[model samples]
Target: MYKIYKFDEIKNELVKLHEIDPNFIDDKNGDYFCIKDEDEIIGYALVKKIENNYLLERMFVKEGLRYKSNGTKILKFVVNHGRGKRINKIICNNKDIENFLKKYGFKECNGHLELDNIQCVNQRVTEGKKVVMSSIIQNIFLAILKITGGIFGSSRALISDGVNSLSDVGSSIAIYLGIYFSNQPADEEHPYGHEKIESIIGNMMGLFLLITAFELVKGSVMLLISGKFEATPSYITILWAAISMVVKFFMYRYKMRVGIETDNSALIADAKDSKSDVYSSGGVIIGILLSIWISPVFDIIVSIIVGILIFKEGVSIILETSNIILDKQDDEFIEKIENYIEKNTPVKNVHDVYMRKSGDKIFLSLHIRVPKDMTVYNAHNLADGIRESLILDFENIKDVMIHVDYLID
Candidate 1:
């Protein structure tokens, strides 16, 4: 991983490029950042205040890493560094560099590249769609494998697990759609964005899983009551069951990583479901082995157990999504915000810190007391700084609104 930090040392290369006076290297008026890969500084960018806004004066990547995404990383760091502020211009004549900046929400005006605040599409939407589609494909393949094996080997447990995988395909598609629509940027009609769509999809998937579980249990129970011992489960059923466990375990890990990175509730719920499938398959394997050795009744019991597990996981997902839909306040998140403000700012008191979630996005509001003699402009600036710090320091915070009050003398 590449790390970016303020550049303190004057390097010979940068001195030649920017004609820096050694004294100017540590100037407080401008911000200088160097990109370090381990201990080696591979790139640097300079952003200086030009009147009210910022100007990207010079940005460079080492010749060896010029076309290898190092420049892109540096540019992203510079953009994020000034996120709540302004980056008015970037001096880049290279067509490749210009195209790269354009992709990251920059546009050329009078031959000067400037930040364009409006984004037509979000990158998370694309990543979420890709992960969800991968889940759908994997589930479909597993469903076919287990269903065919169960039919040929006379294992009701394997068949029940296959049906669960089939249901997951439907749920994955629903999650894909939710990720796509929920990421649509906020508009006039919908001021808060469409993030709640993810919670709604999560609820629907939970209900679907409940219905699927009921059917699985019903089928297994009917077979058990009929006293039907068709035949001993074959070795092929156990083999297929083992394969399902491995596959589901890996899928769970992959989806969980992406879900956490994107903070998508629907994807995370789907990952948890995948995890349950692994345990369910493990039970199927044990039941198949026992049926081959002793009696076929074990297969029926295992199927019922798998259904119960699915129902339990479904209830968990529903409860998780319900909290988001109900706009429950996250006490831990609020406490963190209060602690941050108290420790970092000059506020005499910080109170009323609150946070709520909309899908993966967080909205925060708080009140703070500043010195009574502070100028109105300085107070407004302080509030803006606080908002900016919170948004940058914390992940997924969409906005922060702070109410400033005069402190008691």
Candidate 2:
């Protein structure tokens, strides 16, 4: 397998290519593209911008590598890289490359082959952002309904659940903002992009929920100890609780699906939080029923229990997000990647395969040992192949950085 990249620095192995073939041009005026086979520079292509169009100055494949499809690979890579250019013109003496350029959509225009009228368009908004916005809207609606209903019906459990929903509005807002910022392109200050902001928001929401849960529980406990229970909750509270349960159930399913699909940690946490809301609403209904049939004290007891559940959820979120923030090594994920690299590539040994989660993406860095006699260019190409394959195979993998180590025999 071969990998292609934009060539910048003129390294020793690149110089070796000229030594191997005296005709090889080492022009630095235009953009140089190098195609590597197991780390050796086996082929190259050059493109230069003149006026408003791009000129395909030269394309070549090493003598022995020509008939093996290396030429086609280089042509495809170069064409894709110049897609948005207004006009792509080719100037090549090789008949094979000329045929390839034509087959790849370049047509004879006057004396040179040209591919013209390439169009560039803006990308659509991500699914993660859309889903998070939906969450924020739903939570806001639910918080308003539950708070209004609880206050009018005089149900402590319903009021506490309302506050839970209110807190969810805050959590959903955090998630929305996280997804928004994470989608921004990488800038100088944040080379890795703003993906980690999602994890940080997750942690902050957990802490917020923790504090909210404590206050709710404290309020319920004081009411119980003071022996000043409010009137039995009206039938309206039961209807409101039922409505909340139904809404939260659907919200949970929707968020979980989108979260898994987008691989967004904040969205997943928000989904689980929705699930907790359903359970709390169920408790609210039961407390309302028992208070009407048996005793109003059950209403206060249920609120305390609901508060405990919220606290438990808050702790869970904190632990999960903390692991992601601290770059906790996922042994299973690392093992799977290492196994794939060793089995599918010429890597002699895989080492230090580390990964960290940020928003919906995972960034991986690893070290792999290659043959001691392999040139640095060969090692670099081998690593590039492994990195490309890993990223293509794993959807969540956003980037991979590899270090080449010589196998000590």
Candidate 3:
């Protein structure tokens, strides 16, 4: 039996443990453990309790102790603990971990319905719904706000509204184009598919957001320098801003909900961008009020602050889009891939595991070390099985390539 420690007790040790193996903590939930061999800690495991179910957060053996049955012992300990706690089900993230859990009687549950097991397709559908809904609502609300602003707003208010209107229109067009092109079938000219187009669109959206922020900042500075800031906003401008804030808040919530459900980067980015609009608009409203009560200079200051905030968000979106366009795999995702291979391959060792991402799709490449005396047919079959296992287990994985080599040991 392994020792089970509370999150507090294990958190400190985890810092040290991570230097040896980084994937030893559960990000979602649960207690951490250190498996000892004859009084020496050899590995670590995490058991995340989730609504009467237990998730094996992560299990890792020290590199030197990998082949010494530490992994098996950790699995046994986790399964026994789950049973003792009267938890009927245990979930694991990796396919290899799932197989190991199954050997101890865990069954594959519905991956789509369960949040912990949501597939890529399921996530995409959820995001698509959210984007569609949010886009529609935001467009309508902005149109109304523009009409109201034009009727009763000051020069500054009207100009800001114009910028916002342009941003909304550009974002809508980019989103539509992205969705259309992302779904196109692959052809000879584009073997990897059109998924990267989403990233391109996202980057373009970010660029536009940056430009909008810059313009807002520039306008505010010019207003302040020219002493054009108003001491009071018209009642209609205030009312319109209030209504816009409320509507944008709900829109943000809806889009954020869908983004989390679907893991759609584009939709998630849009949600973030939309949420920023709420904040920006809210600040503008506040600035108008403050300037009315105090001096007109406060309005320019607040607008500058809002512009900086929006620019920060734009930078974030740009960075994320850049990663996708450059085909850079997130380190955590790469680690997950390596862990999956090490645990599931049935080989003596593995190395050079590589992963790349194109939009929501994942591509993996790795080398496995097999026994020298193994038959070529058996090795080929093993490679094929490994690829198929990954495909069946992880829905986001679009492709995998496994290279086999003979191990000297």
Q: Tens digits of per-residue lDDT for model 2 on 135-167?
A: 778777877888899888889999999999989
Tens-digit lDDT track of model 1 for 279-367 = 99999999988888888899999999999999999999999999999988888888888887776666649998877788889988889
Clashing residue pairs for model 2: 39-377, 39-378
User: Relative to the true structure, how large is the alpha-carbon lDDT of every model?
Assistant: 0.80, 0.79, 0.68
Q: What is the C-alpha RMSD of each candidate to the true structure, in Å?
A: 8.3, 7.1, 13.3
Whole-structure CA lDDT of model 1: 0.80
Runs off by more than 4 Å, candidate 3: 1-130, 155-162
Give the least accurate 10-residue stretch of model 2, judged by summed lDDT.
117-126
Residue-level lDDT tens digits of model 3 in 45-141:
7777887677666777888887777777666555555554666556676665565555555565666111221112444644575476567656666
Candidate 3 residue pairs in clash (backbone atoms < 3 Å): none
Residue 184, candidate 1: Cα error in Å is 0.5
